[model samples]
Target: MDNLTLVIALAAVAVAGILFFINRRPARQTAVETVSHRRYAGAHREQARPAADADPQTRFVETSKPKQYRLLNSSEQELYHRLCEAMPNMRVFTQVGVSQLALARGRQEAMRLSRMAGRGVDFVVCDADFSIVAAIELAWPTTGQEIDNAEDVKRVALQSLGIPMIVFRPNKLPDADTISREIADAILRRNRLEAERS
Candidate 1:
């Protein structure tokens, strides 16, 4: 081969070898990235495949049912309105999940919290800055022991987080003034208890 042609052939081979090594080299990934890649890879492969025709029986049937308008019952609605009026300075939220108020520390605590997380309080009272002041449950005459146990668990969970839970009988819901006073009293008591503990 001529000198120039021989040099050109060597250069082409060298370029090919460089490209081969670059393609073969594994990209560096962090522990989190590695796990994420594995998960994503599996999902991507499954998604790439064509989906099977869904069975008619298994498919969802269309319904004429209308969307629900009112979230709370009549008595609950009355209390919700009263709370809004009473706590004008503070924000009042209805049907708040237990998990929103407190956080779990460890795996075991997270498991414990999972049960209570699904359970929600009737109302949550928050300060101007949105810090949780207390949880409120309207006392309704309940039949089942299971419900009572669940409420007890919810109460204990809130209490552990230094949140006071106020129960009010639906028939005897206090006036706005009484509600304001009671909330303030509950907050003071909770602060005092925490102070004593610390």
Candidate 2:
């Protein structure tokens, strides 16, 4: 066959192969991305633990001490407000602790917030996502000798880094002055410890 005929035949075969592959791919057969219900706290939480009973969270009750104020909401009472703040950012991360990423994120943020407790033992408000919020408030004495050790551990590594750190959670806070104080204190301590070690 002449070179022109050979070239034309090869082109035809190539075109046929392309068409065959395209036809084989059915658009309807495409994979569907399913959003898991695990993303919601009320639904997934009950299934996760029948005994823990987030019903206790029904009341946004406060456990006050001379040193700290912690609000408890196991039922996700605080979720509506907190979750809205996360939109376009980490909004999809509702019902923290249900997912590993949420837990990790909360711990990291809490580290910087640990500082404010010393300046003023105001309430440390965290949504139900951070169970520690309850512990910090109810567990500690509000007035005397109260130290936030949880935030301390979060910065154990920073003990040698001396990085100036700060924790800031945007959007509505249960109480601004108190929460900011906690965040600042935590960050300052982390910075101080790191400076001392370094």
The numbered model that scores best in TM-score is 1
The most accurate candidate by lDDT is 1
Per-residue lDDT over 83-173 for candidate 1, one digit per residue giving the tens place of the 0 to 100 score? 8888888898898877766553346555667767677889988889977788899977688999888778888887766678888889888
Count backbone clashes in candidate 1.
0
Q: Give the lowest summed-lDDT range of ten residues in model 2.
A: 131-140
RMSD of each: 11.7, 15.4
Candidate 1 global TM-score: 0.57
Q: Candidate 2's residue-wise lDDT over 1-198, tens digit each?
A: 699999999999999999988976664345221223334645765565535455766644434544444343432334334333432222122222212322243565445444432322112233345322211211222333335465444334223233222332223334434634554465456456546755
